[model samples]
Target: MRVMVASLAAVLLASPALAADPVQGRWITEEKDAVITIAPCGAKLCGRLSKFLVAPPQGIDQRDVNNKDASKRSRKLLGMPVLTGFVENGDEWRGTIYDPKSGKTYRSILQRKGSNQLTVKGCLGPFCQTQTWRKAG
Candidate 1:
């Protein structure tokens, strides 16, 4: 009885950790426009822009001049933190996402669509937009 009870307690305690899938790696957007890399940040998971497959065309304005420090920055938007504090929910993840293009952050959710595909959703209340991402090679 003692061994059985101990084993049950151990399993219960480790359940959370065991349920979490390792999502640390690089993912690319379906359009091949952006790449995101996920890694551990403290006890939570965070993701940042790792690469840009194509640069904004010349004469195209891509700066958000509305943010507090927007005027102090350049047009470069690479390496920005797009996802943060995402907690795993089965095969999906929920958290906050920052969009450099709009200089805004929104509630976000990410799901593994398949072995090499991911779907990311950013929402504000009922309005939501989803984007597909592929595992980076």
Candidate 2:
């Protein structure tokens, strides 16, 4: 029926663009220190620290104590969002990455390296660093 066909078309059109991108999943940092889970935050992609391979020196309750924003310094490391505001841009995702260790935020980009890898880059003007993160199990 026409009604059924129109309903199907509407559902397809309403799907998110991320359906074609495999960025939603768990990934381990290059250093194997932390695991970040990437998922949809409204219409944008965001990553949060799900676990730490190496225990924090300050213990499990470790806080973002170094954050210059005094109000945010007390935030716990676990479940803290590190990558946010990401929007798909062709082959890469453009966004900002927060470095909890340095308490700084940098303009960042995430490029799919392979089926199970991603190259994350953070830039501050002309300075930039790239890390290859493996898709976690």
lDDT of 2 by residue, 1-137 (tens): 99999999999999866523557899999999899999999999999999999888898789998788999999998999999999988778999999998999999999887789988999999999999999998
Mark the 10 consecutive residues where model 2 has the least summed lDDT: 15-24
Q: At residue 52, what lDDT does model 1 achieve?
A: 75
- Report the error of model 1 at residue 37, Å: 0.5
Model 1 residue runs over 4 Å out of place are: 1-20, 57-76
Against the unseen true structure, what C-alpha lDDT does each candidate score? 0.77, 0.91
- What lDDT is reached at residue 18 by model 1? 32
Identify the leading candidate in terms of TM-score. 2
How many clashing pairs in candidate 1?
Answer: 0
- TM-scores for all candidates? 0.71, 0.83
Off by over 4 Å in 2: 1-20
lDDT of 1 by residue, 92-129 (tens): 78889887656778999888766787788999999999
Q: Give me the displacement of residue 8 in model 1, in angstroms.
A: 14
